[model samples]
Target: MNALQLSGLITAVATAGIVVIGLPLAWLLARRSFPGDVVFETLILLPLVLPPSVVGYYLLIALGDAGPLTSAGVHLLFTWQGAALASTVVGLPLMVKSAKAAIASVDPALENAARVCGSGEWEVFSRITLPLAQRGIAAGTVLGAARAFGEFGATLMVAGSIPGRTQTMPLAIYDAVQAGRYGDAHSLVLLTSVLAFFSLLAVARLEQAGATTPAHGAPAGGV
Candidate 1:
C-alpha cells in the first residue's frame, strides 16, 4: 500500500486498540480512587512524557526475536503491526486524559438514578454515561487517531521504513528528505498539515457543540 493507505490502516488499528483498552481504564481512573492508583496512572501516562525514541527502544526489545512475544509465537518486529502498537502506546495517554475528564464531568447523580431504576452497570454506562460523554470520548479518539497517523520515532524503531511495505506517511517523508526529494517531502508535509488541521478543527467543533448543548435531568421512563 501507499504511504497514505498504510497510515490510515495503522491509525485505524491503533485507534481500535486505544478505545478497547484506554476507555475502560479511563473510566476506572475517573470514578474509583484506590491505593496505588496514582502510581498506576503514572505508568500509563509515562509514554506521553518520555522521549518517543526511548519508548521505541523499549518496544523494539519487547518485540524483538528474543522477546517474550516472539517466544509466544507472536511476531510483531519490523512489521506494520509493530508500528500500530507503537502508535497505540504513544496515543493512549491523550485518550485516557480526555475521556477521563469528560466522564468525570458527568454528574454522578444521573448514574445513581439509573441504578435506582434497576439498571445494570452496563446499562447505566451505555444508556446514560456514554450518551452524555460521547462528544468528549469522540474528541479524545480523534486526537488519538491523529497522533497515531503522524507517529514517527517509535514506529521507525519497531517498523523499519520499507517502501510499500511498512513505510507510513511520516517515514515516507523522512525517506524523501534523506534522498533529496524535496518536492516529495513538501507534498507530504502539506498532506500532514491538512490532516492535522482538520483533526483539530473537528475536536474544536465537538467541544463547542458539547458546551452549547443543555444538560439533561435523569433519563425518563427508566433506563
Candidate 2:
C-alpha cells in the first residue's frame, strides 16, 4: 500500500488496540475504588494534557532499539509501528477517560441486582454493565481513533517522516509543505479535515441514538 494508506492502517490498528486494552482498565478503575485510585486515574489521563512531542520522545526512550525495551528485540523508531506506538500513547488517555466515565455512569445497583440473582461477576458485567455502557465505550473508541489519526508531532518525533514507510497523513502534509509542494499539502490537509469531521459527526449520531434507546427497561439515567 501507499504511505498514506499504510499510515492510516497503522493508526487504526494501534488506536483500536489501545482502546481495547484501556477500556477494560478503565472499567476496573471506575468500578472499584481502592487506595491510590485517584493517582492511577491521573496517570492514565496524563497523555491527554501533555505535549504530543514530549510523549513521543518518552516512547522513543523506552522503546527504541537501544532503550529499555532493547532486550525484547523490538525496534520502534523510524517505523510504521513506531508511529502506531506514538498514536497509542497520545490517544490512550482519551480512551481511558471516556471509558471510565461511561463505566462509572452505569448504575451499581443494577450490577448488584444481577449478583443477587445468582449471576457471576463476569456474567453481571458482561450482560448488564457492558451493554449499558457500550454506547459510551464506542464513542470513546471513536474519539481515540480520531485523535490518533490526527497526531502529528509525536508520530513525527518517534517515527520520522519516511515516505511510503512511516509517513502518516499529517506527516505527509507537513513534508509537502516543507518541500513547497503546496498542492500536495493542501490536498492532504483537506482530506484529513474531512475525515476528522465525518468521524465526529458519526460519533454525535451514535451518542444521540444511544441516548434515545431504552435502557432495557432499567430506570431512567441508570446508564
Candidate 3:
C-alpha cells in the first residue's frame, strides 16, 4: 500500500513535468520549421520505441554515484526522485505527441488575427492558442500519468525495490510475484487493471475530442 502511494506520487509529479516540458515543445514542433527539427523530434520520441530497460540502464549510469549527476552532488539513485525521473523519461513522449497534435489543430488564422488586434505573442497564446489546445494538452497529461503509473524497468533501474520508499506499484507487483505470493499479485493485478482501464478511456476520449476539434473561430465566424 505504501508502494502504491509512492506510485501515485511519482505519477503525479512525472506527469506534471511532462506538461511543463511538453507544452512549449509541442507548440514548437507543431508550428516551427527550424534546422534539425526532425532530429529534435526524433530524440523526444525515441523512448516510445526504445526498450524500457535500455532507458533505465542509461539513467543508472547517469545517476549512479560515479555518474555525472552524482559527481555534481545531486544524488538520486535508489530514491523516489530517481524513480520519478525515469518515469518522466518514459512518459514524456506521449504527452508531447498528444499536445503537438492538439496545438497543430488550432487554426493559424486565429493566432494571426489576435496578433493583428494588438495581442502580444504571449497573450495570444495564453488566451487563444492554449485555450483552444487545452483538450489535447489535458489528454497528453493523462497519457503521461498512465505511462508513469505502469513504469517498471526504468524505475527499477533508477530506484530499485526499496520497500516503502522507492518501490512503486509495478515494482511491488514484481516482488510479490517473485516471492511466490500469487494471492498478493492477483489483488495488485486487479487494482492495476482498474486504473489502466480508466486512464485508457480518458486518453481515447481526449484524443477524439482533440482530433475532431474544429478550426478556431468556427463557433464565432469560422477561421
Say which candidate scores most in TM-score. Answer: 1
Q: Which candidate gets the maximum lDDT versus the true structure? A: 1
Q: Mind sharing the TM-score for model 2? A: 0.91
Error of 2 at 106 (Å): 1.1
- Report the Cα lDDT for residue 206, model 3: 71
Ranking by lDDT: 1, 3, 2
- Rank all candidate structures by their TM-score, best first, as comma-separated numbers: 1, 3, 2
Q: Summing lDDT over every window of 10 consecutive residues in candidate 3, give the lowest-scoring window.
A: 214-223
- What is residue 100's positional error in candidate 3, in angstroms? 0.7
Candidate 2 pairs with clashing backbones: none
Stretches of candidate 3 above 4 Å error? 211-213, 216-223
Error of 2 at 116 (Å): 2.1
Task: List model 1 lDDT by residue over 149-204, tens digit each.
Answer: 98999999999998987999999999999999999999999999999999999999
- lDDT at position 6, candidate 2: 74
lDDT of 3: 0.89
What C-alpha lDDT values do all the predictions have? 0.92, 0.83, 0.89
What local lDDT does model 1 show for residue 201?
Answer: 100
What C-alpha lDDT, on a 0 to 100 scale, does residue 143 get in candidate 3?
Answer: 87
Using TM-score as the measure, name the better of candidate 1 and candidate 3: 1
